[model samples]
Target chain A: MDLIWDGLRKALELLVGLDPEVLGITLLSLKVSGLATLISVVLGMSAAVAVALNEFPGKRLVIALMNTGMGLPPVVVGLFVTVLLWRNGPLGFLGILYTPAAIILAQAVIATPIIAGLGLAALQHLPPELRLQILSLGATRPQLVWLLLREARLPLLAAVMAGFGGVISEVGASIMVGGNLKGSTRVLTTATVMETSRGNFEVAFALSFLLLILAFSVNALLTHLQQSRRPR
Target chain B: MRAPLLEVLELVVHRDRTPVLDIPSLRVGQGEVLALIGPNGAGKSTLLLTLAALLKPAAGTLAYHGEALDTEARRQAYRRRVTMVFQDPLLFDTTVRENIAAGLRLHGVGAEEREQRVAATAAQFGIGGLLDRSARHLSGGEAQRTALARAFALRPELLLLDEPFSALDPPTRGGLLEDLGRILADTGTSALLATHDQAEASRLANRLAVMKGGRILQEGALQQVMNHPEDPFVAVFVGMETLLQCRVATTTEGLLTLALGGHEIIAVGEAEVGDPILVGIRPEHVTLSLHTDKTSSARNQLAGTVTKVIPWGPFHRVELDCGFDLSTWVTPQSLTELALAPGRPVVAAFKATAVHVVRKGHHGGDAAQT
Candidate 1:
């Protein structure tokens, strides 16, 4: 109990005073998560709109595949991405293994499915009249795509936030791909794991506290956008 | 007044391999308000959508401005000249001004012109104040008015309305009808509106087309179709509830005695003796009295018991079973004046002019109609 109280006090001190090492880990985590989120959002939204708007053979199978991917374990994603970038794997010439980019790719793989599945659900929730209205209003296919995407901005934002939350808090993918390289690839979750194993409770607690704040802020913003979109 | 601005040729739609709409050649003339009326699931909406060119017909073609409807370019051109206001006022997630400006935006109209047009049309629909307000906040009537203003701003050559007034209040619907009547006349733009309300059709439309089971049962001028509808469905749709098949016997004095259901009653209509006729009258035209009056202008009177009274707004639609089940619409004040109730004997009287003589057997009676 004494040690826990000491760690909490030290964590509060680091937050208030902005300790360099703690701040470094926090910023690096934000960068990796932000990059991963952007990658996931771009790929996810396109896939979601394609599946939601058009019908083709294997459409149901594609949707089922996305549904399965939504629950993919972070460690599994980490292993899969690591192998793709490994020496024996295809396209290993770039040699991006054990780097921040490798970590971003792994986290993005985990986040993509979550963003896509939720995005597809949001698109499905729109009333049929919306499509009919756009068509009847003489909207070209491209114009309609832009219009629908604009209308679904709030949901899409939520999907992005969800993906961000997934990537930022995940430890398994970051540890395997980032290799916990101090000053280079070290992030919040991996740093916390390393500090805790080394009995550095104060550092771990500070990282944990910062991650909590990041997650809370992102979720709150997403919720605010969603509430604003509710029909008056 | 001429061969119509819009003509639909044998437009047919098949849904799940079943024919949902099968409208053979129909036309709407300039400045004419045509009404397509029917009961629920009568393919009224299907026909309207087909006219709007939102759904390609399974077979047949549509023509506007004497040019065949072919190619997306031609269809888009027609769409510029023709527009539809659907049953629900489907507003976008934008301001009322933006919603009204959508059509002009599609044509790449200048921004200043779009604003001016939106303002003018909004004033016309009495929604000028709602311009800056988001469309999601509009009430049903307000949303409908906004949609109308949007469609009107385009000044389309033809307007297809599918139960546009269904969501509006009575006063709003009435005002809209009056405005629509004036606008269509002033612009010389033809309109085809589908509705189930008899009063709506009678007040707004110059011609009425009664549909049933994906086919038009009757189509002609409103009053002519109402008075001498080709089918029982048309008669019922036109508010003719009391239609009795009778054979006119020799007239005694000025009264024409008719045989109905093994009994004889004096019917109010001008018909030749020995002529088999179907006598029909609107419920509102029928008058009920407890006692016969010699001073009444009614040409005929019949005694019947008040069997059922269905209360409508400000009136009661009383059903009388003398020998045939006949309905009479009377004001609530008149119901009290006559002391009418179920199981009470009363005399139903009406003038000969009110009792329209609808010729029967011309189209093989009610069985062959629908």
Candidate 2:
């Protein structure tokens, strides 16, 4: 109990002291996860709207496949992304392996399915007659899509949080694809793993505390947005 | 009518390779409130959607004011000229003001004028106090009022309604119906109201089209369709509750004598002697008398005994056993003055024109006219 207490004391000291190394790792983690979440949102929302609006053959099969993708193992995604970016691989010409870009690419793959599945559900939950009613009001196609998305904005915000939560807390893909290089590719998750493995309990505790704070802050902001506009 | 306001030609709609609607031709004249009435799944809603261009028909040509809506751009432009209200009162998750302003915004109305029109339309619908209230929290009737105000704010050239009052409670439905009837009369806004209630059709429509199995069986003025139903189905659907099967006994110039249960009745219509026909008598057209008057102008007066008295709104339906079963509507005052009761003797009287004759075994391609 004393060791834990001492470790927390030292961690708070490090956080308050504005340690440059800790700050760099935290910012890098945010940058990688934020970019990945943004990419996933764009790709996921487009795919979801396309599937939910139009009816064609194989619709059920496609939805089942997307649901399966939502549970895809991050380690498997890391393995594939590593392979695609490795030297002498098909995409090796870009030479982006063992870098932050590689980690972001892997993280985006991990988040897209989560965002898409939730988005599809959010859009489908609306009343079916709403589309015809809007069109009958003389709305153009783009205006229709905008209005529907606005109606589903609350659920979509939840999708963003879920996507961000999944990617930001993911460590396996970051280590495998990023190589966890010091100062260049290091993030909170990778740094915590490295410090804990080296028996540096105090640093690891600090990093974990920072990670929890970051996740909660981002989610708290989104939750505020999602709930503030609720009907009384 | 010459130079119709809207026309539909050869409209066909299919679902899963099976035809759901196959309207060959129909038209609405200027300033006319045309009602398309039928039972559920009779394609009244589908026809309204098709008229709004929200559903693409398998084959059809739709024209407005003699101008054809042939292309996508033309249809887009045409949509701005009309608005549709659904049965569910589908309002957005916003304030009532925004919900009503949405259509006007889509039509590119300026902000100031949009606000002004929203206010005027809300007041017109008697929802002025609900302008800023959240639509999600409104009662069903208030939500429906918001939906109607939203459509009327556009001041569209044509309005389409799909059972707009069918989902409300009786009192709410009656109030809305009265307000809508008054608004339509004051504005002279051309409209197409789709419903299954004959009372609604009679109250709001200048013309009536009766539909069944995706086809219109008859279409004409309310009185014409109600009195002279060309088809048997139309007779029952139009509230002609009293139908007596009789054989023609004699034919003269523009008149026929029909025999029923050893009784003879005079009717002015076309039919052949010895031909079996069905006589449709509307309950409202049949009057009851305690004593048969020799000076009465009614050609058909039959003595009967009142069997049952069922009280309806403002009137009582008096069932009679006059050799053949018959029913007639009488006001409460008259029911009291005449001392109507079971086993009471009464004379059921109606003019010859009040009875409609439908030739049996003729409801195909063209009714076989004699």
Candidate 3:
């Protein structure tokens, strides 16, 4: 009980004092997760549209794979990204191992399937006749896709939130691929783990609190957009 | 004659390896309104979609203004001159004004022209007050009105309607039909409408095509097709509820006398003596009265007992057992004035012209003159 009280007081002090190291760690966490979410959204939405609207062999298998990927374990993604970026591994020529770019790639791999699965569901929920109606109005194929995306904007925004939340709060992949280097790759999640391991419970609690606030702020903005209007 | 606005030949559309439409030849002429009437699953919607170029037929040729739309590029270009209004309004999740302006925007109309057309079309459909309202918050009637305004704002050369009013209440459907009739006349836009309502087809179409089982059974002028159905299916489908098998007893001038259930009836037809013919009369063309009047101009009048009275909106369908079962339509006012009820005595009168005569075994062709 004494340790918890000490940790809470330190968390409040770190937040109120505008600690530079804490702020730097929080911003890096946001930047890496934010870029990963953006890349995942672009790739995932395109895959979802193709899968949802077109007919081809193995479509069911592909969808099942996406659903499975939505719940992927982050540790496995971290292992694969680490192997790929190793010096003797297949993609080691660029030498970006233990960098923020490595963390971004790993987080993107963990987030893509989530966005893709949700986006496919959102697009499929629309009435089948809507496509015919739009085409009948002289819309080109690309224009039809644009209009349909607009129609599913609310669910798509939810996908963005889910993707961002998935990567920003994950600690396993960030520690493995980001290496937790001080003043370089140290993020809120890794810093919290390090503080706890070093018996500094107060600083660990402060880092955890900062991570929660970061996730909440991003989610609150996305939820505002998702519920902006009734879609019916 | 002006070239047909649309011509379809040897068209076959399939759904999952089953043919849904197998039309051999059909045409919609310039400035004409053609109604395709059929029962449910009769390929009416499939035909409309095919003509709209939204569905590619498995085997067929579609021509617009004498140009063959055989390629994707050609079909896309032809789509600019055509538009369709589906049964369900299917409005976008936006403001009513934006919904109405969508087609014009796709056609590359400038902002000023698009706004002008959208405002004009909205006012024409009495939806001017709802321009700023979100489409998701509209009533069914308002949504349908916005859809129609959207289709018309494009000012396409051809318009296709797929049961546009089937989902509306009768009064709303009637009012919209009236407005659409006037709009079509004023714009002179050729249109093809598919519906299962016989009355709607008769009121809105200059020509009627009766389809069944993915094939066109008959096509001609509305009155001719209604009065002279080529087959038993068509007779019932076109609302000819009363049919009697009669033997011609005599012929004089342009009229023939037929023996129907030991009674003689006169009809305008071309049947020789002792020839068997089928007589059809629409229920609305038959009038009923409490007493028979000899001075009446109707050629056929028979006394009978009212066997059934089915109430339809503002009207009643009275069935009479006058040696033969005859159905007649009468306004509610007349039904009360004549004291129409089961077992009440009544007289059914009809003109010789109302008796549509057709020879047996002559089906799937133009009406044989009578």
Candidate achieving the largest DockQ:
2
TM-score of each: 0.86, 0.93, 0.93
Model 3: per-residue Cα lDDT at residue A44: 94
lDDT rank, highest first?
3, 2, 1
The lDDT, on a scale of 0 to 1, for candidate 2 is 0.89
Give, for candidate 3 chain B, the lowest lDDT window spanning 10 residues: B361-370
What is the interface RMSD, in angstroms, for predicted model 1? 3.0
i-RMS for every candidate: 3.0, 1.2, 2.4
Window of ten residues with lowest summed lDDT in model 3 chain A: A223-232
Tens-digit lDDT track of model 2 for B279-366:
7788888899998878988889999999999999888999999998889999999999999999999999988888888645334423
Full-model lDDT for every candidate: 0.82, 0.89, 0.89
Off by over 4 Å in 2: A1-8, A228-231, B252-254, B288-297, B305-318, B330-346, B359-370
Q: Which ten residues in a row have the lowest lDDT in candidate 2 chain B?
A: B361-370
**On a 0 to 100 scale, what is the lDDT of residue A76 in model 2?**
93
In order, what DockQ does each candidate have?
0.28, 0.70, 0.55
Please give the lDDT score at residue A160 for candidate 1. 83
Instruction: Report the TM-score of candidate 1, chain B only.
Output: 0.90
CA RMSD for every model?
3.9, 3.1, 3.2
What is candidate 3's lDDT per residue for B145-194, written digit by digit as tens?
99999999988888999999999988899989998988988999999999
